[model samples]
Target: EIVAAVESVLAPQRAGRLAGRKVLVTAGPTHEPIDPVRYIANRSSGRQGFAIAAAAAEEGADVVLVSGPVSLADPPGVNVVRVETAREMMAAVESALPVDAAVMTAAVADWRTEADSGHKIKKDGSGRPPALVLVENPDILATLGHHPSARPKLLVGFAAETDDLIANARAKLDRKGCDWIVANDVNPETGNMGGAFNTVRIVSRAGIEEWPRLAKEDVARRLVGRIADHFAGA
Candidate 1:
């Protein structure tokens, strides 16, 4: 009932905009395990992606949220699929095919343990730490963007950079072949990368557009509005 009330309130703002659309969104930081007790991951809290899923659902879209390991509760009317590793995330996303659009917001690990130790390795007190081998994980954004079949009409990727936000984002836009790239500086001072608030730039073939700092919810709403506009034109 509470969810319905909130949806009713948002309906005035989003009615007929995204109705019947199917939107796929990925969220959070993937965990790459080294051993049973050790792993590597990022600081992403998945707030932005979750906000996007919520906003899209509010706009009447059928939303599928493929999330990395996070504690966030699923949004109302959103189908949630939880994953831990980058490979798992990619597989889950591939299985949820034929969507109208997709947003790759998860901070996927670039590398993973070459060989994960099933058992925890104990310190031998040999005064030397064990060497860890790493292998690159598949780039989900690039794969989905360049998929030959079942490709979403519109695909979006997030580029979280500490510096050269625009340049790096533009380069990623070309490399990932996505329709839009959302770039944000993850500098600790800005708190836009993993914090509740975010300031991002949207890069497309047309050009770049900077958005003011706002709560993640607002950013999601604005982005979804843009998606609605594009879909309407298409």
Candidate 2:
């Protein structure tokens, strides 16, 4: 209901700007299992990416959403692919590629336990805590952005940061080889990470587009509209 109302105001009534275009969007926090009973995850709720999927669909694009373990319902008119770990998400994204554009908002865990126990680790009388070894996870964003054969024309990444947001986003653009970066302050105090509203700055080689705080649905609509422009001008 809330998403519908918000889209009413922001989304175009009938825009086919992205007609026949294929867009891929990744959303939510991927959980990396440490053990049979434990895992690592973040605070992402998947609202933003779902909204983007909805908005893209509204623009007449064929949208494929590769999502993490989010509780939210799948957006209408979009094909959704569910995943639990960063590796799974990476694979799903790759399989859905050859897309016209991509928006990666999944808070993929940077590291995962090097070896997860087949069985839950039991606490023995050993007073010492079990030492956990972690290894860096696959860099999905970078991999897709730099994919020579299947790279999307426009690859967008999200940088979740607490400080020096713009600087970090700019660096991410180069590091990830993405065309644009949506940098947002996710400080819990700001209530943006898992919140309904967002205040984001779009960073690209062209410059920065500082958007005002808006409902996540609104942000999605605007971003999708921009994506339409990107393809139209291409």
> lDDT of each model, Cα atoms only?
0.92, 0.92
> What are the models' TM-scores?
0.92, 0.92
- State residue 84's C-alpha deviation in candidate 1, in Å: 0.5
Model 2 / residue 208 / CA error / Å: 1.0
| RMSD (Å) per prediction | 5.3, 7.1
lDDT of 2 by residue, 119-211 (tens): 898777888888889999999999988898999999999999999999999999999999999998898888987889999999999999999
lDDT of 1 by residue, 1-234 (tens): 999999887765435588878899999999999999999997799999999999999998889999999989999989999999999999999988889999989999999999999999788899899889999999999998889988799999999998899999999998988999999878999977667899899999999999999999999999999999999895
